[model samples]
Target: MTQDNVPVLTIDGPSGSGKGTITRLVAQRLGWHYLDSGALYRAVGIAAGWADLDLSDASALVRCTFDTDIDFQEDHGGEPRIIVNGLDATDELRTETAGAAASAIAAIPEVRAALRDRQRAYRRPPGLVADGRDMGTVIFPDAAYKVFLTASAEERAERRYKQLSEKGVSVTLPGLLREILARDARDANRAVAPLRPADDAVRIDTTGLPIDAVVARVLALMPAR
Candidate 1:
C-alpha cells in the first residue's frame, strides 16, 4: 500500500495489561482489520516445539518463521481462529506453555526481523488495529493514533486468572502474577525493541477503570472516523 493508503492505530503494553482485549473491541467498533502480533510469535514457538527444534537455536527459528504459513480467520460470530501450517492451533496457542515459550523466542532479534514484513502487510486500505509489545514504537511508528494501556501488576494478574479460568486453563493467581511481572521485565529490558510508550502515544492506566470507560477514553483521543 502507498503511504497515503496506510493508516493504522497501535496499542502497545505488557502482556495481560488488557491491550489485546481493548484493541479487539476498538477494531470491532471501527470495523477495521485486527492484528494480534503476539500470535505470530506464539505460532512460531509452537511450530518449533513440534519440530523438536531447540528454542535457543536462532537460525532454526528464523527458518521456521519463513516456512510457516499462518492464517488468522474470523467467522461471522467474531471469534478468531488461528491456523498454522493447515492445523488449527487456536487452543494450542493459548496454553501457558505456549505463552512462555513465545516470550522466550520473541527475545531473539533474528526472529523479530523475519516477522517484520508479515506484520506490516496487515496495514491495508481500510485500516488496522495492531496490538503487541512494540507495535507503536517499532512496528508502526508512523501510525495515526497510538495508545499504551497499562494497569497495576496485581490487577492485571487477576484479570488474566479470570480469563484463563473461563477458558478452562487452570492457573493460580499467584503464579500468574509472577509470570506477568517477569514477562514485563524481559519485554522492557530486551535489547531489540524494548516495550515502552512511544513519545507521542497517549497512556492510559486501567487499574480501576471499566472496559467501556477505557474504550470511551480511547475513542475521545482518536482522530474522527
Candidate 2:
C-alpha cells in the first residue's frame, strides 16, 4: 500500500526508449520527486566493478550494492547528479558499459529484491515520477498513472547516438543499435520482473514525436491535482 495520499506516475520502457527523459520532465512539471531506478542499478554495477566482483556472482553483487553509498543530488540548475561512494558518477553511470552491467545484475533475483524497498522510499508527499524497466509492473504497481514509452530500435539508437555525439563521446550508430536490441531482449526475457507494459498503462509510441509534443501528451493524461 502507498505510504500516504501521495500520487505516483510510473514510466517503464526498455533502455533508450525515451522514458527517462519523459519521466524527469513530467516530475518537474508536477513538482514531484523523481526516481531514476536504472541509475541505482548502474551505480551498483559501477561499485561492483570497482570492487572487482564478478557480475555473475549474485551474493557478491548484493553485498556490494548494500555497501555502496548511492545518492542523487540536484545541482543549482535542478539537474540530477548521481553520486556513488562520495564520487560523482553521473556520467559514468550513463555509459553503455554501465548499462550492460546493470542489465546483467538486474536479472539476479536477489539484487532486485534487495533494491525494492530502497526504490519505494522515493515516494514522498505530493507525488513521484519513476522510470525503469519494472516501475509499472513491480515497483509502483499501484501508481495513479502508468506510462510505457517506446520507440523502434532504429529510432532509439539514433536518438542515443545523437545525444552521445553532442556530448563529444565517440560512438557508432550500429554499435548502439546492437546494444539496444540486445538489452531489449535481455530485459523482456529475464526470468524475474521482465520488462512489459502494465495492463493499465498508457502506451505511447514516440518514434517520430517531438519532445514537447510527447511531454504535452503525458501531461494531458495526468489527473488533475
Candidate 3:
C-alpha cells in the first residue's frame, strides 16, 4: 500500500545492471528519497564478517542483523559512504566479495523478514526510488512504477570491472563474469524472495543502451511534469 499518497518507484535487477546509478539518478530527478536495499544486506554481511560469524548460521545472522548499525550518508565525491557498525565500509561494500556475502545473507529467510519493514520505512512523500534484487517483487510490490533492468553477464561484468577499477579496486573481467553467473543462479534459486522480475514490471535490456536512453525509458512510465 502507498501510504498517504506517497508513491514509490522500484528499480529491481541483478548487480551491475546499472541499478545503483540509474535509480539514484531517477530519484534525484524526481526529488524523491532513495533506498539502496542491497546495502542493508551488505551492511549485515560486513558486520558478520567483522565478528567472524559463519554465514550458514541463520540464528547468528539474524541476531547480527538486529545488532548491526547500518546507515547511508550523502554522496562523498560520487561515492555514498555506508556506515557499518561504526566503520566506514563504503569501499568494501562495492567489492565482489561484499556482493557475494550479501547474496548469501539474502537467501536467509529470517534476515529477509528482518529487513522488510526497514526497507518499507524508506517510503515517504513526495516519493521514493528503491533499487535492489527484490524491491519490486517483495519489498515494494505496490510501487507505481516497477522496472527490471538487466544486462548480459559479460556486459555487466565488464561494467563492474570499469567501475571498480576506476575506484582503485582491482578485479579481472573473467573472474567477475564467473562470479556474476554464480550469483545469478544463487539469487534466482533462493528459497525466499529470489531475484526475478515482478509480473507487471517493465523489462529493459540494458546490454548496450546508453544511460540517458535507459533513464528516459523509465521516466516515460511516470506522469510528465
Best by lDDT: 2
- Number of colliding residue pairs in each model: 0, 0, 0
Give the alpha carbon lDDT tens digit for every residue of 3-82 in model 2.
75678889899887898899898888999899999999999999999888999999999998889899889899878899
lDDT scores in order: 0.90, 0.92, 0.91
- Over 113-184, each residue of candidate 1 has an lDDT whose tens digit, in order, gives 999999998888788999998899888999989999999999999998998899988899999999989988
At residue 97, what lDDT does model 1 achieve? 86
Each prediction's TM-score versus the true structure: 0.96, 0.97, 0.96
Mark the 10 consecutive residues where model 1 has the least summed lDDT: 1-10
Looking at model 3, report the run of 10 residues with the lowest lDDT sum. 1-10
Candidate 3 error regions (>4 Å) = 1-4, 75-78
Checking candidate 2 for backbone clashes, the offending pairs are none
Identify the candidate with maximal TM-score.
2
Q: How far out, in Å, is residue 70 in model 1?
A: 0.7
Q: How far is 145's C-alpha from truth in model 1 (Å)? A: 0.7
**After best superposition, candidate 3 residue 7: deviation in angstroms?**
0.4
Better of 1 and 2 by TM-score: 2
Model 2: lDDT equals 0.92
Q: Which wins on TM-score, candidate 2 or candidate 3?
A: 2
> Which residue runs of candidate 1 sit more than 4 Å off their true CA positions?
1-4
